[model samples]
Target chain A: MLQTLPTEAALADAPPKPILQLVGVRKTFGSFAAVENIDLDVREGEFLTIVGPSGSGKTTLLRMLAGMDTPSEGNITLHGELINDVPPNKRPTCLVFQSLALFPHKSVGENIAFPLKVKGVDAAARKARALELMRIVRLPESYHDKNVMKCSGGERQRVALARALAYDPEVLFFDEPLSAIDYKLKKTLEKELKDLHRETGKTFIYITHSLEEAMVMSDRIGVMRAGRLVQVGTPEEIYGAPVDRFVCEFVGEVNTIRVKRGPDGLWSGVDVPGSFKVAPPQDGAALDEAFVVVRPEFMRFLGPGESADNRLEGTVYNEYSLGSRIQYQVRVEAKGGEKVMLVELSRARALPPGADPHVTLGWDAADAFTLES
Target chain B: MAITHKRRDAAIWGWTLFVLVVVYLPIACGALASFNKSRYFGFPVKQYSTDWWGKTVDSIEIGMIVKTSISVALLVTVFSVVIATFGALAFARYDWKGRRLYQKLILLPIFFPQPVLGLAMLLGFNAVGIQTSWMTAVFAHMVWIVPVVTLVIAIQVYGFDPSLEEAAFDLGCSRLQVLREVTLPLLWPGIWSGMLFAFLLSWSNFPLSLYTTGADSTIPEWLYAKMVAGYTPMVPALGTMATLGAAALLLAGGLVGMLVRRRATA
Candidate 1:
């Protein structure tokens, strides 16, 4: 009785509550479904990023979470309260758009103080709080009296951030806030945003089209494709164990080859011929059609006597220097007539130009993931 | 390069000024004729005097006409601008059934000749047991001015970014609050311009005021009746008075506009 009662008592110790949750949320416009069956939980003091291309429903999902839009058929709950029918103004969340919509006619102080003003705070207190927020956002106090339209693009961005933070919501959503900034500034802002998230200890839900930005900032990354969340994991998990070919290609560069399963329960793919093999058959495959996903860095140019579980002999059709690595497109005949195999090598060990086109490519059997068509 | 551009600009300015003078010569001549002391309209004056100005002041009918015109213009300007501001906001924000139809209907009164509109409005009001009075004159003037105000303000509303209102909503403000805080502030310029236009159209209206005004005599009607009956050298003096009144309005409008521009820039 003591052992059983003690386990139940031990389990009573709990973590903090999730700040935001979306349960089976979907949004449809006319006949087109924009966001479908999205279930997400944002924990306290976490920076979660949703990455996808255009029309991928990432922004639509963020909009629902922000209460700017209502989900068609599911519940969006914040702090354990259902918020499906709540309008944006009633929700304790703020969203920053790509345009950084600051009121051009208002001064920087007024722009940052808008939320407080709406709450009927006295003018002097509002200005003081706005100045405090400006300091936190690292904008000069002198800029407060200046018109928002007169500020540079970066300063406007800071004003917008200050305005959103003025609401002091438990959760904040960003809609591609850095997409319009220059490269150098974007890099700096990315680091600053990461530090800010840590400093504020508020949950941040951000949507962006750039994977690099997501990797730079997110504690957890969700990859979306065609209105569905495809993969969710840490940056390293997404890069190394992508759920599908689409997720693999979306996160970074990858090489894919068509394959088929032989009756011997072995996997045979094109471009590498019978010399290469794959373990385990893909589910729901017709015994004859398959594809294997391989990242470029996994494929190596073999030296004499050095060997791998899979190997291919091919002529190097083209080669390019990529920073400290050399990548080559090797044309070879394997299970079928011809295919292209991407081989990458460290620049320190690169063979001279003439040594390519007369080379062997090899990889471990487990390096390639096989998917059935 | 700036100097060359300025010289070309000055040459264009000179030609445009010349053309404007040519076009305005007839009005200028009429104003000049008002100063003549002849009982009959003549080019050269027998002797310039204040006789006509005194004559106009002595006529109680002309004085009443001036008062009626001012009241009617003021009423029409206030009402038309208010209604058109609402109409423009509706058309700008909501896309629904009959939007295009409503817009077309606003312009219909403008398309008809003023006399036709005046006659139709007179008959319509009479049928409705609405007696023609100064109020009816205001209504008729409003019919011509509302479209002008609506169209101008609608153009400004259409150009306005919808995000400003949305941003206000995001900041925990109601729809009406958004209008008060965001829409109206950005729309001040367009609304002011529309109001000015409506005021000008109502102030200068003649034919519509003619039919709808029964016992109340607007300035144009009073002037028309006086012109038909007899030759008073004071008639041209009244014309000069009217011109000066119009110039005063234009100058006030200009000053208000400049003040608004300077405040906005500051």
Candidate 2:
């Protein structure tokens, strides 16, 4: 691993300050806004990732941050200095492209040494530093003289990282660099990248379409939708406490049902036919017309004697094995039509096929987040 | 199965030989005529002699024409490659307004009739007070060749990974530096092949050369001029050299392209 001067221990001893800030930055092309009203603060030595689906403006936001594209509105600052107008080369940051764009014509060492050469580093010194960077990226010293194109995809990625680190930028940006690699290599590189982030302790602003990737590697993940940053928090927070139905659906699989509050000091909606108890209304939530968000893991298959606050009687319409667990889609009759309720249970606890057509799905009110539709 | 595959392979080889004969029959006939022992265009051995070949080389007029052709070819290759390289880079790297218009305009010369281009060049140069000299000829050749160069290289440039340029930029390179260090190195093969196309086109060029060349002319212009006086046996010798030269140039062009593609994929 390549270790910069200020590392995890150094960060623990004295927390680093914010190194970069984007204040209400917006990028537009003609009438279409690619990124609108984006405000973000990147802490020094922290790895922050912005994740979203395709065309969600994650790349555009990262481009603006890297100085490749100028924001149409607002300012981008680096270390309290306005850098919105500064070009990419003038700024002290580097971006790694998705293609792992290693120079095909140059050798691995030459590619890694390109930054130093641009800064007028001598040939001998450049070579030495190139070797050091290769080592930092965990590339073998023998690869320094090898042509970049001769290396495999993962090796090329390491070279790209080594080259970016050669600049010794205050921050480094990754534009979905691992999206092109094979799955096995991608998994390994993700862990290596997380370790590299910790080792270097430089502010890393990465962008990806994979939320799982964002979860594993980032200190915080910002989710974007339709040119707007909907929510920004740790991966756990984004997964657990989504504010809107879109964010809830975007994060992962979830089972949702429309619910309405009745005069019995309880909430019952179209998804529930008879009287049902609902959790106390969330803060600022409407008294009626709310959707209950239940994660697959939260909806457990109930036993005969066991029960939960919210329960639905449904049949196991479909079932599939998921490693140690089995997921069943239970169909139940609600207000207007039949509703499919997802139920997940340990394989050991699940009833055999055809043995349990009628099953009850249950979850605590706390596990079911009620969001205004 | 092995015997069947061998028969099929032999059939393929026979077909390939037939195609080669179809293509090269005329060139082979002309080449044989160059060494004809007879005093006219025939292949029978009347008296095998290298007299016509020697005469073809030693003639001052023909030598001047060869020199002119070589000069124009070299100049056209250099200028076409240079202009087309920068043009291809612009077309490839940046997304700007009028890019489509620029591309359409660059392709205008390819579809334009050669006589019309020649007349256009002649009129344009005359209007601008430039005479129909070798310089004008070279200029006219470029007018035709630039489009070809641009078209060939643009495909190559478009096929290139833009991420390569982004990578260069991230490594602290400016736009020009990226073009020079990354873009040009990758694009060199396309430019070289484009140059070959431009060179061969200008070398054997007749229509534009006729309109624009001066009194001392290119090889094709000289040969056309010779035909006006009377039929001459030396024409086949000159044709032989030309056929071989064109084959060599085209072969070199193909080899360069193959090498470049190999490098790129490597």
lDDT of 1 by residue, A284-317 (tens): 2444676677788899888889989887778888
B1-266: candidate 1 lDDT, tens digit per residue: 99999999999999999999998887777666666777776666667767778878888878887888788878887898789988998877777889889888888888889999999999999999999999998888888888888889999899877767777788888878888888888888888888778767776778998899988887777667778997576666776687678778878888997897676556
Ten contiguous residues minimizing lDDT sum, candidate 1 chain B = B26-35
lDDT of prediction 2: 0.83
* lDDT digits (tens) for residues B133-235 of candidate 2: 8778998998888988988898888878987887677678888888788888888778877887898999888889888876658888777776787556677
List runs of model 1 lying over 4 Å from the truth. A1-16, A263-265, A275-289, A300-309, A315-330, A334-359, A362-367, B1-18, B44-46, B50-60, B231-244
Give the candidate number with the greatest TM-score.
2
Looking at model 1, give its docking quality level.
medium
RMSD of each: 5.5, 3.9
Give residue A47's lDDT in candidate 1 (0 to 100): 84
